[model samples]
Target: MNINKEENHVQSVVRAAHILQLVANSDHPITINQLSEETNLNRTTVWRLLETLEFLHYVERDLPTKGYQLGYAPYRLFSKNNMYLSLIRKARPLLEKLRDEINETVLLSVPKHNGTLTIDQIDAPHSIRPINLVNRLLPSHCTSNGKLLLSRLSIEEFNLILDRELEPITRFTITDPTLLQEELNWVRDHGFSLSLREWDESENGMSVEITDNRNELIGFISLLGPYQRLSKDKMLTLAPKIKSTAKEIAEKLS
Candidate 1:
């Protein structure tokens, strides 16, 4: 093989991989121009690589913004990875126990960009409970799990999220950036966070952090229910129990 030709091929593969990393790390959907600027590559090269990646299901276009985001291939690979599966398996019994004890929804969620993604949940036994939120991406500014996760991020990372619009889901949702920042500070101090009719008018929730062996936040354990059943006072009363359950999960994962 020609040495120069082989080197060029290797360089192209490296550039493509770099592009993928940039898209994966972005909190918002990234445009071809943005990718080009970030990767220091020409627009044409970036577009070509994105097209190939899109064809392979590694990335896809966000139609609304005409930007790019991770596609199904990465998620498929993640699902096959034993780590996440192990986490779910190890945490299930404890989550079930919490649900049984409280008769409210208990969930395991982790940060996804600027939002929280519910990985698993044990639904409340009540017929009139809040709808299932598993596998949903929820706003960081308006959710208990989301706020808990956000509190763990670095100041720079947190600012990146605040730079974007804080869409209000309900009148109770905190849309003012300054107020949200103050609330996050309180969450950091309190070791727990709450969403009192913020995401849904009838729903309320509270969450505690789950840390790894290194004491790094890895996820959140949340309790959610109708406002009538999960009043602020009741959630405060149950906070210790939820924190205890989160500790057990962290110990098991470690």
Candidate 2:
């Protein structure tokens, strides 16, 4: 048995994982020199490992800072983990309660890059409810949950998304950047957002922000239904209850 060769392979894997961890834990992009100093590996070895990790999208180079940050791979893995499952599990009862109270579809969504990813959903009792949006990445500018989540991003991050051509999902969708900016400003100030037949001509939704104990935005809870049943006035009237429900879910998760 070539024990030395096997040991070398294992050592390489361990060093790579250590480098990835350092990048993940950093508050800002981490330079290769910082990784090498922390890992006690030589610069060449660190660079080679980083090259492999970057190729696999486990780490990505922050071009502006010339440093490394976590790539898409970790987030994809995180989405499938027990922790993510635990979040859904802990919040399910409250979501169900909200749905029962309002008899409207309830959606749980989180920010996914420039969009919103619906993680879980509770369908409304009415047969005429909106279609299921679970496991879909919908445009942030067109959905209530998307807008509420986007409102929590830093100004630089928000601008990056805004710089993209905002696609219109429906005639009512906010394709005008200036108007969208105004809408998001209102959402940030009020801690909620509304989408009146924006994503779909037949459906309307209102969303409330969910935050952790530190008040950091984590996700959103949205109530959706047919436009006839969930008119703008009705949604505004129910806003307090929906916001309270979101707070309960956040507390449960925290």
Candidate 3:
């Protein structure tokens, strides 16, 4: 084919790929008109591309909404590994970099139904670092990751969860719902969370949320280490670095 024709064909393929991605990431199924508006293409061209994608099982159209959504083929291709595993894989390098920079134990965590769960961790390269709590459920009232995730909840949801007895995990743990709310409020305002020896007197954690493109909190990255060295002032100083690392991971998720 001529160079001009070949270039036009490649551009068309790129546009089609963009269309498939838009359908995959949309919050809800999207209509042809919406796709055209988003892609700056006419309805006829978008419809032709959607027809080809539907034939290939890359996307499917909804009868009721007349909208397009990702098809089973995409899930089949991605299901080789679980989503969490993929996230961890994508985040490992960033986590390692953060740990090396701060020289503190770095952990990745996501919120659970009743509490928060640690998904992955990299131990600090120091001799007397904090305990590694991998694949463990942690109390939400005191830990930095827990509070950072909790800060995403609406007031009513937060109140409902806090209605239970707030057990004190350590001498410094916050056992009062009102006081914890204040802390969570501060976390939301400051864009980070602090454990301050609440989970364990020997360890302190500083955390920031990994928010997606929509600005929704999906997970968080935290730095935990010996409280003697990772003091409140030090945590504050490292907060920006941790937040930058989390932002890098979040962009990958997007």
Q: Estimated TM-score per prediction?
A: 0.67, 0.66, 0.67
Off by over 4 Å in 2: 1-83
lDDT of 2 by residue, 129-211 (tens): 76667767888889998887777778898788878888888999898878988999999788789999999999899998888
- Sorted on lDDT, best first, the list reads 1, 2, 3
What would the per-residue lDDT of candidate 1 be over residues 1-254, giving only the tens digit for each residue? 12224454687777778888888877669999998878777899899999999999999999999999999998787787645677888999999998999888898988787588888988876888766676788888899988887777788998888788889899999999889889999998888999999999999999998888788878889988889889999998998999999999998987
Question: Which sections of candidate 1 miss by over 4 Å?
Answer: 1-83
Q: What is the lDDT of residue 1 in candidate 3?
A: 16
Tens-place lDDT digits, model 3, residues 1-254: 12224454687788788899899778678999999888888899999999999998999988889899988887677667655888888999999988887778899988888778888899877878766576689988889988877888888898788778888889999988878888988998899999988988888888888888888768889888888898999999888888889888988877
Between candidates 1 and 2, name the one with more favorable TM-score. 1
Look at candidate 3 and tell me the lDDT of residue 81. Answer: 62
lDDT of 2 at 218: 83
